[model samples]
Structure formats: C-alpha cells, structure tokens
Target: MRPRYTVVASLSRLHRTFLTAPSSSDEGFDFIFYMTNKAKSINKALNDAVPLCNNPLVLKIHEAMRYTLLSGGKRVRPMLCLAACELVGGQESTAVPGACAVEMIHASSLIQDDLPCMDDDSLRRGKPTNHKVFGEDIAVLTADALIALAVKKLASSTSFGVSPERVLRAVLEMAKAVGTEGLVAGQAADLAGEGMSLEENEVGLKHLEFIHIHKTAALLEAAAVIGAIIGGGSDEEIERLRRYARCTGLMFQVVDDVLDVTKSSEELGKTAGKDLIAGKMTYPRVMGVEKSREYAEKLNREAREHLQGFDSNKVAPLLSLADYIVNRQN
Candidate 1:
C-alpha cells in the first residue's frame, strides 16, 4: 500500500469516530477539550515555575533563562511524553514533571542553537533570539542554567509517582540524548558539513543520518521511551514505542526540511531559507523534495502500524500527532 494511503486512511477513520463526534452537551465536550488544553497549560506553568533567584548575583541570569523558556513554542516533545505516559496507562498528572524536564531540555537546545557560534539566526518562535535580547553571554548562561535545572528538577520532582529506578533511567536517557554522543555530536557534524561538497557516499549519508537522528530524533525517542518507562510499560512495549518514536522523529525532520524550503519565516516562527544559506545538509538537499515527502509519509504509516496492537482510543493522539508532524505548516 502507498504510505500516504495507509496513514491517512486509518487516521481519517479514527478522526471520524473520535474527533468528529457530535456532542449532545457542550459541557461534556468542554471537559474533553479541557483535558487537551491542560496538556499545553502544564508547559506554561512549568516555564513560569523557573525560580526568580533572589540572589542579586543570579537574578539577571534567571530572568534571561525565563525569557527563552517562556517564549511561545509548540511543546510537542513534552506533549509526546505525556501522550506516551497515558498510552502506557499512567496518569497525566504523574507525568507532568518528566514532561517539564523534557521541555526545559528542548528550550535549552534552542537557546544554544540560536547562538552566534551555531545556527546564528536572530529570531525564534516569532521573537528575538535569546542572544539578541539578552546578549550572547547571558543567553549562553541561560541555556546552561536550563540544562542544569532540567537534571535537578527531574531528580527532585519525585512526588509525581514515578518510581526511583524509572526516574533515574529517564534522567539518564535524557542526558544521553542531549550529550556529546547525541545532539552535540550531531550539531558538530552539521556545522562541519557547511561548504563541503556532497559526494553521494554511503558513509556521508550515514553521517548525515547520525547527525539528524541525534540532533532531532534522540530526545523525541527519549520522550516516548521515558514516558513508557514511567508508566510501567513492559520492556517489549517500551521497545515498540521506541521504534515508533524513532520513525516519527525522522519523519519530523524530513517535514521540517521541506517546510524550511517551502514556507515563510513568518509562517515558521523562525528564519526560513537558513538551511539553504548555511548550506546545511537536509533531507530535501539529499533526496529530492517529492522523494523526501514520500519517505516521511512512509515512515508515518510504519509508525502507526507499530501501534496496531494497542487500543485505538489510547493511541489516537499519537497517531494524530504523527499526521500533524508531516502536515503542520510550522
């Protein structure tokens, strides 16, 4: 079956049954809407929770940290974390801390990526880059603080009902995903690839895959895996979720590349054509645009297939999210 057909057919059916249901009472619909709304509200609450250090010495630093953390961005990774937790039968309240930690890490990465030494763009999520507003030194410091705080919060937020072992594993997985073996190495390679001529070597593709997978996919994979772990999923289920996350993460990047080339900066909430200007390697740069889109659709279908044994109601959000991943304009 064609990938688009496979994914859309199932998703369309699910949407018709769940998302399209006509509610007899606005109150009942409102409650369901509230539950979805709460998932997004938690990120705002966590961002606001970043302590305003009373120490005059660190107060400015804290402010800069809050500036970027509170900036509007889709809390997709954290949402995935919560969704994964629910899919594995954990309460959303119990998953909040882990979700927050993931968002903090994601926000920190954006700060660093926006630095002069990195992607060097001056806008993010439709606002001035952290470095532009706070100065590079403060922005760098803020990113560092967020990273440290993410670890500390994950370690300290034990009241959320995740077991000690599971919390430890989640923290370790997050650390690995963001560390040198993960995002950092990918970034280094991405930066190094600028101005280099493409030779179509399989080795080069492997390197590109490593960079994209780590830089974009590792944390996403970790989000799902950590959620499953915290939710008491069996090892087999966790592995299956990991596979789904991996595919979706890559699909996310492919769609991102497509959008970067096709969409506007205002639409993207970030600079468009930066990839082209920077000469960064991307899916569209490697595979033709049509082929990349096809690949992403294929991956989305495979990801949904991986969830087939689970109750459709439970996995509905994830499946919808996968479709959103490819279809989103931003």
Candidate 2:
C-alpha cells in the first residue's frame, strides 16, 4: 500500500481540484473593482469607531463583538447606514455611531444564526464560527450582550445628539427588525420548515415572502430608515429611503440565492448549497435560475432608480452598492 503521507497528499490535491473546478455559470461580480473605495472607507470607519466603547462591561462585550464584526464581511449594512446619512446631508462622523450600532446588531444575528440549533455553521468569513471558537453558551450570551450594547451606544452617542423621541424610534425600529417580527421570526420559520415541500400555491408564496422580508430585508430597511432619521431627514426623504431599502433588501436575498448555487464554499467564506440541504425556500429554488437572475437584476435597477431624487454625488455609493449586491459572487 502507499504510505499514509502520500495518501494524505493525494486527498489534499483532490480537494483543491474539486474547489477549483470551473462551473458553467462562472460569472461573478468583481467586488474589488466595484466597491474598492466604499469598502475601504467603511472598514476604516468601523475599525476606528468600534474601539471607542470604553466601559469595561461594554469593552468585554465589544471583545466578543469584534471577534465577529471585524472578521471580514462586505460591510453592506453599515454602508447602507452611512449612505443614507450622507444622502440626508450628514457627515460620516455624525453617522458612524449609528453605523456601528447596526453592524453590532447584524453581527449578533450572525452569531446566533451559526449556533448548533440554527444553521450550525462551523465557519464564517473564512474563519472558525463564533460558537466554534468561544463555545455555544458564551457565544449566545455574547450575542445577546452585543444586541443590548448596540441599543445603549445609540442612546449615548453624543455626536448625533438626537432627540429622545428619535432615539426611541430607532430602538423600536431595530426591535422590529430583529425581534419576532423580523430576523428571529424568519429564522424560526426557516428551521421549522426544513425538509418541507411547498406546492406552487399561495401558501408557498407566503412562506417565501416571510422568509425573505423578515429574515433578510427587515434589518436592511431599518438601517436605511434609522440612518435617515438620525440625520434629521424629512418625511419624504424617509419614505424614499424606505423604498430604496426594501428594494435593496429583496435584491440582496435574490443574489444570495443565486450565489448559493453558483459559488463555492471558499468564495462564500461559508458553506454553499446549505439552503438546499436545509430545505429552505429560496428564489433560485422557487423560480428557475435564469428567472431568479433576471428578477435580481430588475430589483437592482429599481433600487438604483429610487435614489435618483438625491444628488448624484450623495447617491453614487448607494447606486454602486445596489449593483454590487446583485453582482456579488459570495
């Protein structure tokens, strides 16, 4: 028989070969070229602002928070927040805290979603998942703490000096985004419906809409609306921003479904095709792949169109962001 080392080497080569195998549908969004400046600016802002949570308890929570938050993501939510603020004529400094708050909440949800009871993902952003690194109990507690801290930071951040009413509004919107009405409900439904079959009927559509609108789109909508509110935007501006956010949210989920079939685990920085494995309802699984791609592009166009009322310079990032969302590979 061949030596054990040789067998191991051969298996490694096979794994690499599998990963690099070309797919027929190899089109992937060139994210580096598309969002280079926006990504860099967002990262710099997040790194600088995240370290400022100075209280020991907050700092401990921030440690767990940074474990995942700083772990490399597209920074889409925070970018939405900052873009919404800028669209309303607010400076980046004035909006950084809200951006950070949204990011924290997003990170917490990711952590919870990766727990054993949920997706049980072992990796995220190409690294060991939060539960994998810190143990499930601590990971769960950490996520809970970060959620609370996000609200606390929003309340205390003096840069915005937002009215108590607006701050409360932000909290309520965030609660709706992440509470039973939002991400949590979506997650529960996703898990509960695993391996369930849906006929082409109204019930299927209801399940699909609930999973997409609540689990994915709600937080994104909150990010845009909250950023606008914090920046003192008018009612009309808020309405427009909501429309943009909802469109982008749906677009984001469609692209995610596309990526699930087209991308690899390494490219996604997490398991690919898990949606099918989990039997979760997805656009690609519901609509055919070609139709799903077309739908995503349509929503992307609509999202960009919603921003036309704002100054071109102010809305450039948001427009580019919509394109980037539909076009992302991972």
What TM-score, computed on C-alpha atoms, does each candidate reach? 0.87, 0.83
| Model 2 misplaced regions, further than 4 Å | 1-62, 198-203
Q: Output the number of the TM-score-best candidate.
A: 1
The alpha-carbon lDDT assigned to residue 267 of candidate 1 equals 57
Q: What clash pairs does model 2 have?
A: none
Give all candidates' CA lDDT scores. 0.76, 0.74
Model 2 clash number: 0
Tell me the lDDT of model 1 at 1. Answer: 34
Model 1 Cα lDDT, one tens digit per residue, 158-205 = 677678988898889889988997788878888887766767432466
lDDT at position 121, candidate 2:
89
Q: lDDT, candidate 2, residue 276?
A: 85
